[model samples]
Target: MDPLTLGSIVAIVTVGVLFSGISVAAGLLVVSGGFLIVFEGFSALSLMPEIFFGKLNNFALLSIPMFIIMGAAIASTRAGADLYEALERWLTRVPGGLVVSNLGACALFSAMSGSSPATCAAIGKMGIPEMRKRGYPDAVAAGSIAAGGTLGILIPPSVTMIVYGIATETSIGRLFLAGVVPGLMLVGLFMLWSLYSTWKSGDANVLRATTYSWRERFEILPRVIPFIAIILGVLYAMYGGIATPSETAAVGALLCLVIAMVIYKLWSPTKIWEVLRDSTKESVMILFIIGAAGVFSYMLSSLFITQSIAEWIGSLDVNRWVLMAMVNLFLLVAGFFLPPVAVILMAAPILLPIIITAGFDPIWFAVVLTINMEIGLISPPVGLNLYVINGIAPDIKLKTILVGSLPYVACMVVAIILLCLFPGLALWLPDMVMGPEL
Candidate 1:
């Protein structure tokens, strides 16, 4: 069979298997193995183990587990609640401040955790119920939290970015730096839509009767500020030439544990064990996906599917913007079914060369791709964040959650456009601090 025809079959079969409810790692391995045996012969199967092991051998991947530990530690504590409360106290006077604060909390927690579901669970647990109690619509209450949670992958210390960096052999530090401005831009976009939504619905007036004394507002800082400081410290360590991404993650993980212990008194052996266990489980899952993705990539290359596709794309007479639009559409669909990590692992390698050849900055495209994954977290069929919000408020219909998240989806698309129009939104910080990539 021709490579193009075989590639289409593989793509369709892969999607079918994923939607069939098998795990992503299993799906990728099964599809890759099956295709290789059927097409490349049994001898090609021998390299599977070697290929998988080689993918996981990278030193940069060390950051993933450490960052997961940091997220798990903070998620296990009251940090989410404290962060939300602190923001609420300060923003209470602002219209739609309650929901706005949830978006802020999601962005901040995302910076700390770098996991969307964790961000949603952490903040949605408190934010959703509070918004509903304050008379916000179920859609707005559930949707805002769901959409905001996606910031996890776009913010610094992001696990998705790490996977992308490792897969494409890009600098993880530069990828992290590139994410900062785009992350902030998405946060601002979410916030602006939040403010407008609340005003239009008159939900802004909902908080009019709620007020906090300055002391009350300031009181929550001790609990929240430490985490924010840790986030800042991690960013500084990465951008300041003080440490590699892996080293910064390790130190940041330790600080997260220490502070969670000191402030939240989360020092019990069971609690500590839980943190480690969760971290291990998440880390192993992500690593397995990376390994499977490696075999998948190898299979495609051996079959000439990857090269054929890249050559076809490069041969296009369309403008770079058109190529970007095509890439973005593909990513958005891929994200709807696969987790961000899996998507990055499988797609980044195939797309990176094409992106660079087209004269776009890889760092900038990384930010754009991360934002596309953000939309998928709240989208349907495989919308992990939406389900997390559902878990937080089971009473809210999934439809309502989906409805509420729609605006934020639009916000993300807008952010992507803004980035495309001004690539500097993602490139400026990284270039300024790290000196532009040669």
Candidate 2:
């Protein structure tokens, strides 16, 4: 059989088997990757060594474990709970104030945790019950927590950015720096939407009319200062060239550990062990996916599928904006059924080259792709965040959370358009800070 047909068969089978949920990880890896090797013979098997070793030897990949450890440690601590209390007092005066405060709290926690599920679990445990008790609708309460959860990927110390940087060989430090402004922008958009929805619906009953004195507001600073310090230390060290992105992550992890132990008093030897164990498991899963994706991508390239696709795209004479709109449509649909990491791993190889050939900056494109992926997290049929929020609030229907996420999805669509129309919104900061090295 021809190599192209063999490669196409391997690709289709791999995707089909994985999505089918019948094969376990080891089985899928061996079956999908092994079949390609067996059919293609020893020369193709040689690529496995490169793919395996190349993924394992990456120094930047170290950040994955460290950041995961940091997020897990912080989530296990009481600091996150305290941060919520502090934010609630300050933000509760406005309409849908509690919901808005939930977004604010999640954004702050996400900057430290950098994992959406962790952010949702941590905040949902606290915020969901509080909102329900205060007469907020279930959909509103669940939706806000779910929407706020996505801020994890946008904020600093983001695991997704780390993965993207490692995959594309872009500067992780610059990606982290680039994400800050856009992350904050998304948070602001969510807040405005929450406020408007609440005001129009007159759902102000959930907000308690509480006032915080200057001293009280300042006192809560002690609880939040550690998280801020962790974020700043990571970004500052990276920005000042004192540390590589991986080293900065290591530093952040250690700082998070120390703070959890001394400042927050939540660390025990067993707790530390647990955090490490869990982080290792998660890291291994991600690394396995990366390795498999590398093999899959290699097969596609060797078979010339990527080249063929790129050429096909290049032949098209559509307006650039229309092309972008089409890309968004494709991603939005893909996100409904596929996991974000899988989507990135599979699509980045094909679409990224087309995007670059079309004169779009990869850094800017990363921002756009991330926003699109964020929509995937909340979109129906397989929306991961909706399921997570539902898991937390079992009494709330999935439909409620899905309906609530629509407005935020609309917000994400607007964000994409803004980034497309004015690429500078995403590009300018990175350019200024990284100095035009694209």
Candidate 3:
């Protein structure tokens, strides 16, 4: 068979296996192992152990767990609630501010945790019920949290960015910087939609009457500001060349644990244990996928599938913008079935060369690719954020969550278009901090 034909078959079979509801890591290992044995015989399988283990060897891998620990520690405590409440107190006077507060909280918490589900669950628990209690529509409340959770991957200290950096040999710190402006841009778009939803629902009068005294607003700042500072400090350390990604993550994790214990009284052994246990579980899951992806990558290379496909795409006579559109479509479809980290691990290396060859900045494309992945989080079939929102508000109906998140998905698409047109939205901060990519 031609490499292209065999590659198409492999893609179909792999997607089929994943869509069968099997574990992603297991599905990848099974598909890659079967293919290698079929084409290259059992002798070729010997490389599997080294390839899998080798994925974990990078110094950057340490940041994954440490960042997870930072997220897990805050998620396991009342920090999410406090963060939500803080935003709510300040935004009470503005029409539709409650839902807007949820988005704000999600963006901030995403920077802290860098986990989409964690951001959804943590903020949704407090924000959704409160928004509903204050007469926000179920779709509006649930959708806000679900959509906002996607910011987890687009914001700084993002695990998805970390994975993308490692996969494409891009700098993790610069990737983190690249995400900042685009992340804020998405938040701004979400907030606008949220306010529009409020006005459209005729709830502006009710929200207008709601007010918090200066005292109430100021009180919560101390609790929330420290966490925000931690996030900023981590960003500064990495961007200023003060620390490597792993070192920054380690310090940020420790600070988060300390703050959680001090402010939320999360000092009990059980609480601490839960934090550690959850972080370990999530980190190991990501690491396993990376290992499996390494083997999967090797299989494609051995069979000449990667080169053949890249060559086919390169030989196309399409404009660069058309090529980008096609690539975005492919990433979007892949994202529906695979989580962001898995998609990045499996696809970024293959796409990076194509993107650079087409005269696009890899750093800028990282933000665009991430925004595409964000849509998948709220989309159907395997939209994890949708499920998380449903879990938090079971009575809201998954369909409502999906409906509410659609506008936010549109916002993401718009962000991608803007990135394509401007490019600077994702590249400016990174360039300012680290100088332009060579």
Span of 10 residues, lowest total lDDT, candidate 2: 23-32
lDDT of 1 by residue, 1-438 (tens): 888888899889998998899999999999999999998799999999999999999999898999999999999999999999999999988888898899999999999999899999999989888887888889988999999999999898899888988998888888988998888888888899988877887743365648799899888899999999999998898878899889999999999999999999997999999999999999999999999999999999999999988898999999998999999999999989888888898888889889999999888899999989999999988899988888878888999999999999999999999998998988888889989777
**What are the runs in model 2 whose C-alpha is more than 4 Å off?**
1-12, 22-39
TM-score of 1: 0.98
Please provide, for model 3 over 65-140, each residue's C-alpha lDDT reduced to its tens digit, 9 standing for 90 to 100: 9999999988887778999999888887778888888899999999888989999999999988888878777888
* Candidate 2 CA-lDDT value: 0.80
Q: Model 1: which residue pairs collide?
A: none
